[model samples]
Target: MHSFTVQQINEVLQGELVGNTTHSITGVEEIRNAKKTDLTFIGNRKYAKFWADSNASVAIINDTIDLEPGENRAFVKVKNADLAMAKLLEAFQPETPVFETEIHPTAVIHETATIGKGVQIGAHCYVGKNVTLGDGVILYHNVSVFDDSTIGPQTVAWSGTVIRERSQIGAQCIFHNNVSIGADGFGYRPADDGRGLVKIPHIGNVVIGNGVEIGANSCVDRAKFNSTIIGDGCKIDNLVQIAHNCIMGRSCIMAGHSGLAGSVTLGDGVVIGGSASIKDHTTIESGATVGAGSGVMNNVKAGQTVLGYPAADSRDMLKQWVALRRLVK
Candidate 1:
């Protein structure tokens, strides 16, 4: 339990204090849950109702507000109280987590692998031959990087994440728990004489651009020849399936459970809603948005908003709904 006097907080935030400046704040809290020894901030004027006879020792407030400071609670005035609070919180917050710098006893790192500075290889991790890990990379428990894999600087792979051989992930990428990259792509043919199926080999790997964030339990499969590319600044949500050879452009956003089939191409600033499915080889242009539960089979023009199965135009979908409602009347 770290304690900071009101004077100490003002030094950190360079804010003005008034009304019983001698009071000290023990901890920070939300407006509704604040205790007598705590400091809570109020931003919106509508939330001022919660401040009546509040138990907090101090209120960090914006300078624009016209209010009187009471004896029970002092006021720390600032241009932006929220941003000021962030500074204080960061200063008082715990240090960046330490996974031991020394390789764990259970970790198996191939001798040929190249690991850069400040790397932490956690329990039971397996690094294959020729794998290259950049500076400040942290691989949590049971994560595996197969042969020839390369992870860029400042990346963190959470527990149970797996990168198949030859995969390449860019800088500052975060792979949440159980993410599987460069796993076998689905390419199969019916066996001879109507026998069991024969699965073709997935020969390619994945290339993730810088600043891309992939969520938990997502699977991005390997392509046949070329790399399956995730463009820079792409944000993907949980349980999404990115099939082989799909290329996402910069700043594309895909919501939870969305699936893109093989060879799909998405332009910059495209937004895909939750549970949407884009068909194979489809091309979606820049700044286009596909609504939730949409099934996109054809190309979506730039700056267009589409919705529904087979993805009709947004205006068309709305008109159809309106006509359906008029039928009942």
Candidate 2:
């Protein structure tokens, strides 16, 4: 366990500290569950209301909130308490798994594959012919990099990740367990004789930019013609799906269970809420926010917020809801 004095934690957060600075914090916990030796945070009024009853030794609080540190408890006031807590948690993070050797005996590497410096290939991992793994790449156990694929420097693929042929992933990207990149897109057409469906071949690949992090079990499908591109700094949540030929601009955020159909386009900084689905060929401009559970069938203008089953302007949807409630009354 890691331990730090109230004063030391305050310095790390660079926040204003009030009350006792000598108390020791052994770990972090939720506001309601915190012990006397634990540290916690109050990011909003909901949590701030419980401060007086919390037994935590130190609490990081948002500067916008007006609260006092009671008795021996200390308060580290910052502009954003959540972000401040993130820094401390990173500092206290446990060590990650280290490879026993750079290349494990059970791993398979093709003679034509290019392995860069500081790469670690774990047991049962496979690097196919013509695959290029850049410097500092780490492939955990059971990971597979198929032919002609290229992974950039410092990229990490955890256990069970599969990078299919011709996929290109950029630097500092992370693929969590069971992530599927360059998977065949879901496409089929009715046969000429109407006997059965004909599968449409996904002949292209997936191109992901730098600093992208895909959560566990997420998938990015290969394109039908050109690459399905994910711009730099996008953060994808677990169980999300990006379908064939989808193009995402920089820093887009997709919540858990959200999905985009084939050829959907998102501009920079678009935020997709949980379980939201975008129809195929739809375009969402930059800074647009799609509310949770929304089914977007039309284009969303830049910076607009949409809501409802078939998403509409947030204000319009709210007005319609109000009218319905009045009718019920």
Runs of candidate 1 with Cα error greater than 4 angstroms are 1-96
Q: How close is candidate 1 to the true structure, as a TM-score?
A: 0.79
TM-score of each: 0.79, 0.98
Global lDDT of each candidate: 0.90, 0.96
Tens digits of lDDT, candidate 2, 160-188: 99999999999999999999999999999
Q: In candidate 2, how many Å is residue 182 off?
A: 0.2
Model 1 clashing residue pairs (backbone): none
Q: What does the lDDT come to for candidate 2?
A: 0.96
Poorest stretch of ten by lDDT in candidate 2: 17-26
Clashes of each: 0, 0
Displacement of the residue 145 alpha carbon in candidate 2, Å: 0.7
